[model samples]
Target: METINARSWVERFIKTVVDQAGELTELDRRAGDGDYGTNLRSALRRVEANLAGVASDAPDAVFTAVSDGFLNTGGTSGPLFGMWFREFTRSPELTTAALAEAAAGGVAVVQRLGKAEVGHKTMVDAMVPAAEALTAAAGRDEPLAEAVRAAASAAHTGAASTESLLAKRGRASYVGENARGVVDPGALTVALFFDAAS
Candidate 1:
């Protein structure tokens, strides 16, 4: 199997997020502060601009660079995502199992910091499912790309499911039942990340 370098992964993620920025903003407007896309776009732009200075072959170093960029960006999502990427520094390899473990570690950090769980109508809704899918694929000894594809598919489904769930966390929770029927932008963003990896 061909190994995907960190640079390729980062590039794909940035491109996907930038291309879908407008849609993400619209999703946020329906249930959030309407600035999720703008915040993510700005953060990603910084990541892209600094990517050349990062070590392309070292996943940990690349993730560290990405974490710093996101952490410096001004937004709730930025810090949360930065923490998630920071955890990726512990990943030992780019294989399916390693990636799944890294993703689960990132989810744990998010849960600890955000205090959100599945069915909370937050990014955890998507992230948890994606990590689970990746784990299952890894257990089956699937290729890294296939495992990532499974994660992407699960993330999309999980993000979509949030539309029917009442918000239980974040600013959207303040809207109570009215938040139902509008997808969580954070969850959608997590899904997009896995999709780009695939």
Candidate 2:
């Protein structure tokens, strides 16, 4: 399968993120700081402005615009998401191999900078699973749409799993037992992005 439509994919991502900002923020209010949804929405606004000047459908150009918004946005999760989006700019195309590589690379980078691991009740939980799913799909020579769906499903499941775990990373860790039963906002954001892709 070929790569996804660069502009279309990111466009869907922005719409979904914006549409769910309230829920995202609510999740953060329960688990971490209450500003995640606001910060994310602000970053998406920046993305909108950035996208306005984009005349190309090329993955590199489109993804770069998307990355710049998050990279420039304030807040911990925003910048980490920026860096994750930045990984997509590494390859010119979002083919199965490239997509898998970018997701894995983004996860590694986020883990390094955030000092997060799977079971941390953070975005890393969803991100790792998504990347793994993409990698496995690529290995199996799965079609792009199928691979994307698998990745999305993995991400959603990973995000949902966070509700049962106590936080071990990020601000959510500070609230102790209160964070339990609340989904990780960052993880949910990751799930939302993958869902947008599929």
Worst 10 residues of 2 by lDDT: 1-10
Worst 10 residues of 1 by lDDT: 48-57
lDDT of model number 1 = 0.85
Error of 2 at 60 (Å): 1.2
lDDT of each: 0.85, 0.90
Q: Model 2, which residues run further than 4 Å from truth?
A: 1-3
TM-score of each: 0.94, 0.97
Clashes of each: 0, 0
Q: Write the per-residue lDDT of candidate 2 for residues 1-198, one digit (tens) a residue.
A: 455788888889999988888999899898877999889988989988998998988888888898999998888988899999889898876787888999999999999999999998999999999999999999998888889899999999999999999999899999999999998989988988888876
